[model samples]
Target: MLQIAVIGAGVFGKNHIRIYRELPGVHLAAVVDPAVTLEDTPVFASVDELLASGIPIDCASVCVPTVAHAQVASQLLRAGIDCLIEKPFAASLAEADQVLALAGQYGRIVQIGHLERFNPAVTATMPILTKPMFFESHRLSVFTPRSLDVDVVLDLMIHDLDIVLTMVNAPVTEVRAVGLPVLSPKVDIANVRLEFATGCVANFTASRVSTERVRKLRYFQPRQYVSLDFARQDLLVIDVADPAAAIAAFTQGAGLQHPSAGLSLRKLPVENGEPLKLEIESFLTSVQTRQEPRVTGQQGRAALELALEINQMIAQHAERAGLL
Candidate 1:
């Protein structure tokens, strides 16, 4: 069995610990957290303590805060341990690159915690996502003081950015973004518009000051429109150019109109499942096979770079508005 170590015992880190403890073909070697006492397992005060103990660890899940990601991940990589670092890989793109370079040099695997990629709703919609002409997404959460250190672009919108990059499959040509610091010292709300080389465009908005949580994505294609509700785990597929009578019959049967009566939407059902488990399973598979993960360190760096750009734009806008 592959021996794994979990660093950090915060909210997210606890979830990682649980998953690692239960995952098949893996042994939870130790838990390292300076902030918490790991009562269920052998606990180390810090990663240094565990590494210095000479425990056999093949991989580690770095669930530390975003600011500490680089230092922790780099140390592990240098020690020849593969890693799965949580989202927004590091505080900056340069730091992310350093971890990635160390992974490459040491021939170790590194995966990013873009958990939405493993969501069942997202997986179910992948096969039908053909040449998206336009995409829109919104990820909003009720006020939580957890991520006040960074803007909403990195805290929330980066998830959509990772998914968009996967579906669009084209180089981004331009990005326009705006944000404001409504509830926190950092930007709490933001919107970004991405123009792709393949004529596909994605407009994303995220807010941490909202009253209700929402996670949704809408895709417009040539013949159909697909909408996914990550919160509800529901998918909707609508046929735009239904020219046949059978199409009309199907729509009529489903209480849908002929695109003229505003009843063109169709619902697609998705199986409910835990996305985090899927993500961890994928990471384990990559570790066993010596293959690159679906969400690699480089991909995480790209998303972080774009997120930083959005953060900059928001800062500039906030400054011009005299709200800084």
Candidate 2:
């Protein structure tokens, strides 16, 4: 059995703790948090305490604060323990590189917790992707005190960012963004427009102070448009094409705005399940098989890098608008 411990006892960390206990061939070795304690499990004040306690830990989930991610993950990796660090891998690119280098030296599995990639809708939307050119995404949630340390770009939009990066499979050539702080000192809402080297464009809006919760993404490609509801675990694809449209026009304009006489909309089949459960299960599989994870540290860094850039753009816009 693989022995595991959770480094934090916050909302996300508690969820990880619960899921680990339910998965097969894994033991809830310990819960490392001085502020909170879990019954029927040994508790430690910190990773140092957990390491010194002599409990055999095969792996751990680093769900601590963004600032602590690098330090906590670095310690675990150097100790030869595989890790699954929650999203926004680290506070900055330097810290992200630190985690990757540590994992490389230790030859350990490091999975980034970009949970939406495991969402049923996203999984179902992948197979039919063909040069997606335009995208619109909205992720809104009721105001919560959790993850207020960073801006909305990192807290909420990074999930969509990772998925978009994987789908586009191209480098971002330009980014235009704007954001504001609401109900917190940091940016609580943001809107970004990205231009990729492949000529694809994506627009993203994220808000943590919304009155209602929404997690949706819609994109268009040649003769196809897809809508993905992350919360509903549903996918809808619409195919529209002009029979006489030239190959260039079909590849360039492809049903983005106006559909031809022929159009069909249908829902795609989806396998519904908790994304976190799928993520942890995949992490365990990589640990056992010594294979690459679905979301690797480098891929997570790409998302983070873009998110950080968006944060900069937001800051610039804020300063220009005299909101800073």
The candidate that wins on TM-score is: 2
lDDT of 2 by residue, 91-130 (tens): 9999999999999999999999999999989989989998
By lDDT, the best candidate is: 2
Q: lDDT per prediction? A: 0.87, 0.92
User: Residue 83 error for model 2, in Å?
Assistant: 0.3
Please report, as a residue range, the 10-residue window in candidate 1 with the lowest summed lDDT.
Answer: 254-263
- TM-scores, in order shown? 0.92, 0.94
Candidate 2, superposed: residue stretches over 4 Å from native: 241-261
Q: Superposing all C-alpha atoms, what RMSD in Å does each candidate have to the true structure?
A: 3.0, 3.9
**Local accuracy of candidate 1 as per-residue lDDT tens digits, 1-324:** 999998887888889889988888898889888777765678899888998999999999998889999999998999999999999889987899899889989999999999999998999999888889899899999997786667788889999999999898888898888898788877788888999999998999999999999999999988788989987788989776544653556656644554343436666667888899899999999999999899999899988988887777777776788876
Over 4 Å off in model 1, which ranges? 243-266
